[model samples]
Target chain A: MLDAAIVLANFVVIPALSYGSLLALGALGVTLVYAVLRFANFAHGDTMSVATMMAIYCTWWLQSLGIDFIRPLPTALLAIPFAALGTVGLLLVIDRLVYRHYRQAKAPPITLVIVSVGVMLILHGLSRMIIGVDEQRFFDGGRFIVSAGEFKEWSGLKEGLAIKSTQVIAIVSAVTLMAYLFYFLQRTRTGKAMRAFADNEELALLSGIRPQKIVTSCWILVAVLAAVSGTVYGLDKVYKPFTYFQLLLPIFAAAVVGGMGSPVGAILGGYLIAFSEIGLTYAFKRVAGHLLPPSWVPDGLLQLISTDYKFAVSFTILVAVLLLRPTGLFRGQAS
Target chain B: MSGRDRVYFVLCLLLIIGVGIFQSWNVALTMINFALISAILSLGLNIQWGFGGLFNVGIMGFVALGGLAVVVVSAPPVEEAWRAGGWRVLSALFVAVLAIGGSLFVWKRWRPKKYGAVSLVVFLTMAFVLYRFLFDPAVLAIEKVNPALSGFLGGFNLPVLLAWPVGGLLAAAAAMMIGHIALGLRSDYLAIATLAIAEVLVAILKHEEWLTRGVKNVTGLPRPVPYEVDLQQSIWFQEWASQLGIDGIEASSLTVKLCYMVLLIIVLALIFTLCQRALNSPWGRMMRAIRDNERAASVMGKDVKRRHLQIFVLGSAVFGIAGAMMTTLDGQFIPSSYQPLRFTFLIWIMVIVGGSGNNWGAVLGGLLIWFLWIQVEPIGLATIDFLTKPLHPTSPLRVHLIDSAAHMRYVMMGLFLLLVLRFRPQGLIPER
Candidate 1:
């Protein structure tokens, strides 16, 4: 039972929390874009990765210059602000050059998706061309902050849980960022303008909300959030170009599941998806062992499915949700 | 068409030929192969998106399944693995199909006045048990066979060329299932659903190793083109090449490649002619009318969903055929090799770049963009090398930059796509 609990804590809880945080950040970007831009920005994932890669390089540069930061933490923390600025510039330029034309044309939603697909390919190409296809690991600073064994001793439990320092930082930062975002959306004038536009674009326009400014601000926020999310995720795991491309499905899933344009729903959806993915593949043998008699305990781990099928869990959930509740649980907006 | 129009077409062809001259013949031929496949894919997309205005983002899934269809159709059956786990796997599939059919039947029979009130739970609970009962043991038996290689049942060892049609059939079948359920949904919802389905399909291809050979990959597939080695050794070819004052080996190799190019061109010409005829037909005009205004068309008495389904299936079949062609050309089936960017979105770029509504434009775009996709890597590398030529021989940046240049093609291709979408959404060769 203890062994099972330890594995659950290490694998299920931590991954769920970490991945949830990452998805929340990614979904925030998605939601913000949908609200202001009124189109799904497919290039957002690669934009995140590009920002993270840039930040990672800056971190390395800063380190080489002997301008090191706090121990046990990544240097990307300090460089992220600059990375966000650069990414915002890139996105703004792209918007002006590529998306502005489409906006001017008053293209349909699907056309915008096609245009975004083009943009996504360009960004994908740029990232690959600039960075190369190798899996670049930026891990160097330190190891685990909360050792599993120590947690076991402190809790006075047989099961010990290991939590990486980055995971802790990720969760904390995600919460703080999300809180600030909610406050900004709920409290600020521009935020209100953004929401009004999202709610009723024509009405909001008639009410005097400047569409361009709102759109620009949305891009800035999205860039920052994407940078933070991508960098932190790269730090937590590893940055791979291909993985970012594949991540489009899940990130979109989270956005759709959370109810597009709803921050709270996006956050909730992220956690829901993360839990489904981690929990589905998680074996209940150790957890189940505790409840069952010795004679009745099953042979082999009682895993519902293999870990390799993790993505399937999210897809299944998304399909089921869409089939049952098309607008999602919260019904925040037009899917 | 006017004489000037004919002249312009000739000019475009000349430009393509000029570009091909600089690159190796092998590269040019490879581009032709990709172009044919992509044109077929674009045609499929044209039916759903171009003709029906239905958003079908699951092109990747259909194409991947089509690729898998080739493996399922062509590769020699591993009798031992089949004996080990074939029935179990088939049962799993059977169970899933039955569960789905049964659930739909139940949903229809109950006809609950309010959705999400009661019947949903019943459907889900029954589906879950049926799925688990079928999936779990089938997976286990397959795993028990080899786990590492050939764990799954293999293919039918049929003629490789037939795989193309088989792939199309499979994609059509899969698309019908998806289209039936999703066509009524909003465009965005349909897109999301399709995207998710594609991911699931790819996942199955990657994990269901017993069938696909998984990550180990199935290679050396039978080819319509003569093997390069075999061509090099043919006595008649050597004598003919010597008479022509060319190296026999080189001549024969190029000959084999040229043969492939001819075959691909023939396929493209056939498909293109067929599409042209279809577009001119009343049926095609109806599709376009439907796309331009679905509600209006439906009000006029055309069954919108049914029409959309036909286009969707037709388009997917084209993509399936192309996928099979790609597999045959490579003479290998690599489940892990499929990427949305490489397979799905890249083709989208080709179609958009070519001219979505025009078959000729699609083919042109297919060929041109494929050429650019392959050439951009070399172009980037050469530019970087030239720029860094004066730098230290051992400079780390030099090596890194040179190495990194390989990725520039993706960036270039993407930029090219955006530029085309922005500046010439109609494409260089606009549909007449």
Candidate 2:
């Protein structure tokens, strides 16, 4: 039973928690834009990619300059702030060029969304052109926080549970960032203005909230989120442009599931989606073997669905949430 | 058509002829064939987006379903795999579907009755266990029959042309299922939901080895037109080729492409006429009314949701037909080939730039955009090479720029799209 518990924890819990954090960060960006801008930013994934690509180049440049001062952790950690700045500039320019036009024109939200699709294509092209389309692993940090051998020896358990340093950093950073975001939204003046604008734009404007300033601040925060999440995710796994784009689906799913525009729900929805995705597709033959009698061992892998169906799992949960609770768990202001 | 539209078409023809002059007739013909397919896809999208104001970005999914329909229709059945475990596999599927259907039926019928929910849960658990018990073994047997060659159940060996209509039906069905779930909500929900469904369909295609051979791919689907080798072997073909003063091989391939073009043009004209008629009809006017103002149309008792659903299905069917046509052209069904950027967003650009509400505009956009989509890489590459001439040969930035120049087309295409959206929102050939 203990062995089974260990296996379950090793396979499902830790991975899901880390993955959930990544989704939370990505969803936070999408949610913020949806709330303030009143349009689903289809280009969020590509924005993340552009930021992560910048981070990757920064890391390479730093490594070349012999700036390996952060020995135990990835040097890329230090490069993230620079990437965030670049992202803020990119997004602002995009907004000024593309979105600002539609916003000024008083176009419908869907039309704005369509413009974002065009933006998505441009960013996608830019990222590919700069980074090239291949998987790049830039993590030169300590490989593991808890190696399977170390755990096995330390605990004297048959099952070995390995925990990577990247995963730990990802979860910790995600929590830290999310905490700061929550604090900012709940307590800060600018955050309040932004929230007021999102809630009722005309009323907020009448109440002396500067709409342009609020939109600008929102985009800045969104850029920060996109940069941090994109880099953290890249650090945890490898950076692939297409993979980053695919992340848009699950992020949207999380944002929608948690209730769009609700920060708390984005976090909750992130973990929900991550747990369900990992828990459902994970094959349990070994874990089952540990618990069951030798004679009653299962012949098959005991997986409900295959791993390739990962995207489908996210969609299923999204659809189910839409059907059962259209507004989401936290009662977000859904379209 | 206006003189401006005529000019646009004439320019497109000149461009094709120029490609034929500089490149080859084969390339030009290939361009024309694909442009027709793209136009068909654009027309389908224009129906949903332009005619009915539905924003569906899941064109890739329906197209994939159409491609899948081709494999399911034309590919010969793997008899050995079938004998090994096909019936058993079928039965297992039947049982699983029945269990879910039965549960839903019971849930709906006795929602107010005591113990209804409990009974449903209890019944589902047993049903699932029984299903896995039956399904796991059958799948293992089928996969073991011929893992190298024919591991999965193949299609009904039907005529290739038949696959187009069948593919359309399949895509319509998919659109219906997806629409039933997503429609009647905010318009954006349809966009996201359809996007997710498209991804799901592609995922199913990529992984379900039992269905369309998964990523291994189903190739060499029997062509409706004569094979080039057969044409080369015929005595009369060689004489005809000599008379035409072209090589037998070159002439035969061109003949095949011409045949394909004829067939594609026929289908394109048929769809264009249908869409043109629909656009001008009372039905089309009503769709435009709903699009322009849904609240007013609903107040007028126009059944907005039903009409949206209707157009959504019709458009998806058109996408599916084009998908099958594409598969026929390629002579294979490669599930991995359906990328959202190419199949979904690019087509959206075509429809937008072509004048969404006009059939001729769509065709013109299809031809023009497809030409650019094909030509942009080369153009970008040559331009990059020329610009980078001043840089040293071994410079990393220069080498990287040259090597990655192919991606510039994306940037160029995006800029073009943005430019059109900003400057010419109505597209090159505006609807009358």
Q: Which candidate achieves the best DockQ against the true structure?
A: 2
In candidate 2, which residue pairs get closer than 3 Å at backbone N, Cα or C atoms, i.e. clash?
none
lDDT of each: 0.79, 0.91
TM-score of 1: 0.93
Error of 1 at A102 (Å): 2.7
Provide DockQ values for all models, in the order shown: 0.64, 0.77
- Give the alpha carbon lDDT tens digit for every residue of A209-306 in model 2: 99899989999999999999999999999899899889999999999999988889999999999999999999999899999998898788889887
Poorly placed runs, candidate 2 (over 4 Å): none
lDDT winner:
2
Q: If you assessed candidate 1 against the hidden native complex, which CAPRI class would it receive? A: medium
lDDT of 2 by residue, B1-432 (tens): 898889999999999999999989999999999999999999999999888889999999999999998999999998988888788878888999899799989899877999898989998989888887887777777777678887778899999899999999999998898888888768676678788889999999998787788888999897889999999999999999999999999999999999999999999999999999999999999999999899999999999889988999999999999999999999999999989999999999998898878888888888999999999888878888899899998899889998788887778778888888888988988877
After the best TM-score superposition of candidate 2, give how far the Cα of residue A133 lies from its true spot, in angstroms. 0.5
Please report the TM-score between candidate 2 and the true structure. 0.98
